[model samples]
Target chain A: MTLTGEFFAFMSLALVAVIGGVLLLNLTKVIHMVVALVFTFVSIAGIYVLLSAEFVAVVQVMIYSGAITIIMLFGIMLTRHHGEEAEPKGGGLRKLLLFLGVLGFGAAVYLGIYDLNFEAVPNTLHENNTEQIGISLYSQYIIPFELTSVILLVALVGAIVLARKDDEKEGDKE
Target chain B: MSSVPVSAFLALALILFCIGLYGALTKRNTVIVLISIELMLNAVNINLVTFSKYGVNPSITGQVFALFAIAVAAAEAAVGLAILIALYRNRRTVNIDEMNQLKN
Candidate 1:
């Protein structure tokens, strides 16, 4: 409850994340939202570090902040959006209803979970976290790990198939 | 090392989730809505890691789940954006409200 260095670090990171998320929601420009999203993802990586999940933290930064942000930028560019009004605004009543829906869901979850007290386990990873994660992933969870790769392959193929323009139209015209 | 309480992270995830939910629900732009969905997934990652650290059985399983979630999220974003680009090529706009061709 009292102030400590951990508390300060967590507070600052959490504040940055919340602010970034808020800005992402309210920002009028797509590029601004992507930047805010990067800020939020980086803050989440910091939180993962705080939780002692170093491997997850690294993956978060690499995948979420680095790969995902760049891909989104590419998407925006390829889609050919023009000028500053790229982000369209929602209607007032719809916005109010959406806000209320989110508020209600958050309140319900908080009310359900607030009463339960959680005891913090001291140092979940006794050895190297990356080693432990690798061992577990390769040994016990190998099926899912391989399945994930397959999923990625499928996604790659799907994206290429969907995004590539068909050449049949030119052939048919000839 | 004075440990931070589990409730703090939980609260943070809650706020992030709600913000994401609001954006995903109300945003007119398809790309922003996709970004909002990523936000919600990140909130779930925070919760999973928090529980893995603080839970009674504390193990690497939750972290592993988070890893899978992240991979899946990346794939989802890639595919979603690809689809969005395809739609844009045909429709020339990214507004979700105007894409009412399926309403017939």
Candidate 2:
């Protein structure tokens, strides 16, 4: 592949994304880790744009980078005073083993895809991309779309119920 | 633009997935574990969108699937945070290792 602008874009985005993930892994402070992940999520959105998925890219920015990260911070804030992720005795050994296992898993998967190629069929997904997704969601995927709304509602109610302070339990504890 | 091979995208996803896996498995903080899981899901979304564009059957279906995945992930985050809050209320700690009430 000749060095083109697209290649450069993909390269830079992927580098930033990888660095973000690495920082998330290595960062000591949980809040700092969350901040690092914003970079990864945003870079992935850029990757989506490179793949001609403008609508999905925008959604990724809104949902993952914006909504979910904020929700996580809220979770952390409510929980309060979580010190550094302290490693237990012999935990360093466990972490090393896990890292090796993950590396092996990644290598195995990479071996399968390192030579992956497909016939380049020029398609018009880039043009009116949002329109295509909307049409598909409404027509072919109408049922699942509606079901997603139902699931979201259920999750909303369930979260409220699960998180509500129980006066009787509080009385018992007191 | 087409010069960037499908494998490059696939490799990126794989690397991210491995990082997520390692983080989820090793991190003791419950919220960070949840965050790592989110990273794993994000990696899968990348793979889905990549295949949507460059796979044998290039269609808009993959993008639709990615959208649904995003919705489900959002719901998951909400519920997970709620559960974390409740767990912290009872246990007063966010360490995954120490919250083993069910281990007995």
Error of 2 at A54 (Å): 0.4
Q: Highest DockQ among the candidates is held by which one?
A: 2
Q: DockQ, in order, for the candidates?
A: 0.69, 0.85
Stretches of candidate 1 off by over 4 Å are A85-90, A167-174
RMSD of each: 1.9, 1.4
Name every residue pair that clashes in candidate 2: none
The CA lDDT at B60 in model 2 is: 99
Q: Write the per-residue lDDT of candidate 1 for residues B7-86, one digit (tens) a residue.
A: 77899999999998888887777888898999999999999998888877789999999999999999999999988977
Which candidate number has the best lDDT?
2
TM-scores for the candidates: 0.94, 0.97
Quality class of the docking in candidate 1, CAPRI style: medium
Candidate 2 lDDT tens digits, A1-174:
999999999999999999999999999988999999999999999999999999999999999999999999998887776457676668877887888899899989998999999999888899999999999999999999999999999999999998986646888889
Cα deviation of A69, candidate 1, in Å: 0.5
Q: For residues B1-104, could you state the per-residue lDDT of candidate 2 as single tens digits?
A: 39799999999999999989998998888899999999999999999999999999999999999999999999999999988888998888998878888889
